[model samples]
Target: MDKSNFRFDDKVVLVTGSAGGIGKTIATAFGKAGARVAICDINRVAAETCLKELRESGIEAMYFAVDLSKKGEPQRMVSDVVDAFGKLDILINNARAGERLELLEDTEENWDITMSVGLKASYFATQKAIPIMDSQGGGNIVNISSVSAHVISSGSAAYHVSKSGLSQLTKYLAVHAGPKNIRVNSVSPGLIVQDEHRNRFKSSDNVNYRTRAEQCHPLKRVGYSQEVADAALFLCSKAASFITGQEIIVDGGLIIQDQWALLSNKTHTTDNI
Candidate 1:
């Protein structure tokens, strides 16, 4: 396939949560694709670091610090991207509340903040971005959902609920906006690992948590940040122009597999007899 098919030359992309981890990787991918990217995160320093990396690689990039949990912050984020680049072409909603490990003990405050930051931010950001897209004739949105949204996990109930809400929001926006040529979609990742995530999940050591997590994946490994970013870049580019309201799963086949390992049982023929 021609690499040009994936090129996003001159397009202005707004990517939220793009300081480090999955968000940073997605920003870099868009930059490499030739899109002018805005790296927005609550951490300005980290966002700027990502922007520097992109610039060093000869990509047009900028950085912004905005808290999505605040009202109007999303709109301002969109506005900053538009103001910098003159038009908005792609929107990647990649920010989420920190992973909640407790199922029942997670507070309602935590849940509300998660929704406000993740699901609510996407909605308001879209609200502010759609008009710009319409004025420019069309665009796309990629919501960063998680596989936990579809599959149940014993952990992080609030995070799971927020992602599920965002996933449905992806569909609703797609339905209403498709006629206007703005495409909306979700990319759900499972067990994506980066240095930061690895450190966060590390436990005192019979075996590293990563190895354990990797074993659970059908592919026998967790995915990289770049892998998820690649999926995001494709959905945002012309290559996926015909795609909308789709939930692209990048879970290393874990989503499809019934079990990660074959179960073994010992049976004694003499005992059975």
Candidate 2:
């Protein structure tokens, strides 16, 4: 494959919640593609560690440890990225907050946290980035959503609602941002297993959970952060210049199955949820 098609030289990228997991992977991918990256997350230690890793890999990167849940933080982070990189060309809204409670059991605090980080922060950050992107001609945005936005899962009521809102927000922003030459899209990952999950699956105790997850998808395997990163990278690349206001589902065909098949597959266990 001609790798040059995805080259992002001279571009500046800011990835929220890029301390670890899918966010970190996406940030690293963009950096490797020759873009200066700003790694933003609430976790100071993890953000610093991610920055160190990127530097070690010879990728230009900076770290910002700020809580997106707070008012003005999202806008401030965008400003900081612009100050550091001169201009921002790519924005990936990957930060997320969730509570594992059912709708009735969910609290106001939990709902606020979920919305603040998952949806509100992404919305405001994009709002701040639009003008900067417009001034520079154009830019790209990829919001990291989840399959939960489409499928109902037990518990995690706030998380589901936040993701659904995010997917819709992507469409809404794409329509308005399109006039400014900015492209907005989303990637919805399903059953992506990060470091902690890999470790858990290593133990004999959680083997059933892993097996059930694999069976839930047509690919017979759970996804990885890298897979989701690939989708995000593609959407941010010139390859997707004409694609906007759409969601690319990165699930292993998990969403295509009927509700009855999913329930029969024993994939709806609280553990998987």
CA lDDT scores, all candidates in order: 0.85, 0.90
Checking candidate 1 for backbone clashes, the offending pairs are none
Model 2: how large is the Cα RMSD against the reference? 4.0
**TM-score for each of the candidates:** 0.89, 0.93
TM-score of 1: 0.89
**Tens digit of per-residue lDDT, candidate 1, span 1-273:** 667879999899888988888988888888888888888889977777777788999988888789999999999989987887899999999987655769758777787778888899999999899888988899999999999888987777878888899889999999988888999999999988764666565655636766767766767778888889889888877788799999999998776664422343332223545
Cα lDDT of model 2 by residue, 1-273, tens digit: 556769999999999999998899998899989999999999998888889999999999999877999999999999999998899999999998767788778898998999899999999999999999999999999999999999897877779989999999999999999999999999999989885467776578988887877877877888888899889889988888799999999998898867785656554434664
Q: Per-candidate RMSD vs. true structure?
A: 4.8, 4.0
TM-score winner: 2
